[model samples]
Target: MGACVGCGGSQSPGVFVLEAGTYARCDGCGLASLDPLPAEGAAGALFEEGYFHGGVAGGYSDYDADGALHEANARARWALVERHSGAPPASVLDVGCAVGTFLVEAQRRGAQVAGVDVSPWARAQAEQRHGIGVAASVEEVAARESGEFDVVTFFQSLEHVPRPDRLLAGACACLRPGGLVVIETWDAGSTVARVMGKAWQQMNPPTVLHLMGRPSLAALLGRAGFELVTVERTSKLVSVGLVLHILADKFPALLGWLGVLARRPWLARLTLRYRLGDLVTAVARKPLAVVGT
Candidate 1:
């Protein structure tokens, strides 16, 4: 009933339906998106303090509770960036940088890092706790420092935005020549997504606006003036408590077990690092010749 976020083409109903809304796939680009879209202020409301503590739907349960696991996840992602790009960037901006965990890791690696998040709580925490420059949104960051960053990252946050193209454009506008744009997001075209269909945990509506595939993602980056570099599946190191917290949402029976595990500090701290293959990390670069173009 609405135009697709990926291609602006007519959309057909998708296989999933949640309490929030129905989803549809684009005939042209095949990106699945929520229909009717989220009300203007609705999406931002999802990132409040309640989001990290499981008070809100489609959000984590106690995101800050596992500090060591979060840092390990950030280190894994930073390793991926170094493997693909081969150097520590001079400056970096992280979009949707909740609590600045990744930016903290980037700073440890000698990158000057700034972050933007919709949640004031997150922004304040990033600035106060991590000492990173934090703002309310990418537009706000662009206003103060356009074309000033050697890297722009959207780690597991792009699909949550209502306008991904606008987000990418703002990131591109903030990058220096030959700078990189790194994205970690759900890949709807991946084997796991195809096999799991509507039951995929990433299909939560309203919170997740678009499910991007590799081809659509490439087209979007190209349109935003980035040349594709690498796109591949990436793994994360997550605590057992966090994984159980997420799974408990879809499978309520797991809650009893999760509750038991939560009381056990040793078991809760266990970390798993494995590739699920449904999520992808991509790197793209702005050409050196097109600094302002």
Candidate 2:
């Protein structure tokens, strides 16, 4: 394993990237990816039991607090929605659309939104609760749903996939010409990563196989046959706080609730570090001429 998207140096490499301070930078494309990504089968288990739907959703309780999180999510949704002016396309697809938050927002804006997620629990909850269409798999959705979409979004869901290239290909396939693929992911090259080092929450191992940066991601999209039209770095204030909380919680026995008090007060210096970062949003357009790559 060397400098390839899915390739990395094998230090005792099994099937997944298992070390710290080491990454496989793709030669084909400069997208730095973690090698020995989770096994194909292991992905489902890791996602189902290890993170997301596991038990961490509660950590996002701030979202439901007095509708503050919902308000923030709605703001993000509207920002993406406003980006696409004129007419809301005929339909849209949201891959890895957990709980269909964006789907609901898109629907409210008069777009026919459908989503696909691996978790049956999330799908059922979306349909039962939100009344949206959800498929169990991308392949199943592709087969059942035809025609192209105006927009395809993968918010905070790209890094979770073991194979980002394959996932991008699939996402591109679902879009119509001139369609947009709006992606929001953690920028590993951001100041947060630079300052926090390995403690950054997005760097959580065994799950996030790729720590994408702006340049590498743009390269990956170009190679995937998409033109990077617009790139915006949005402040992920809550997410940064969440990462800090995760770090604090990891040392709960040591920090306890007083972790809020920052004993080594120099850390207070990094307080503003949270707001300065971005979620690295890129709106890549599927070429109007090319149907497939």
TM-scores for candidates 1 onward, in order = 0.92, 0.78
What is the C-alpha local distance difference test score of each model?
Answer: 0.82, 0.63
Best by lDDT: 1
Report lDDT (Cα) of residue 199, candidate 2.
56
What's the distance in Å from true for residue 282, model 1?
1.0
lDDT digits (tens) for residues 180-254 of candidate 2: 888888787788777865555665565566778887688667766788877777654343334445656444475
Off by over 4 Å in 1: 39-41, 261-263, 290-293
- Lowest-lDDT window of 10 residues in candidate 1? 36-45
Q: By summed lDDT, which 10 consecutive residues of candidate 2 come out lowest?
A: 57-66
Root-mean-square deviation of every model? 2.3, 5.5
Reference-based lDDT, residue 80, model 2: 65
Judge candidate 1 at residue 194 and give its lDDT. 84
Residue-level lDDT of model 1, residues 1-293, one tens digit each, is 67766666777895468776778878888878787677544566778889887676568766877777778888888887777667877888989899999998998999888898888778778878977768877888899889999889999888888878788989999998888999999899988888877667787876888888998798778878899998988877777766776677766777797778777878777878757887789899988973464
For residue 94, model 1's alpha carbon misses the true position, in angstroms, by 0.5
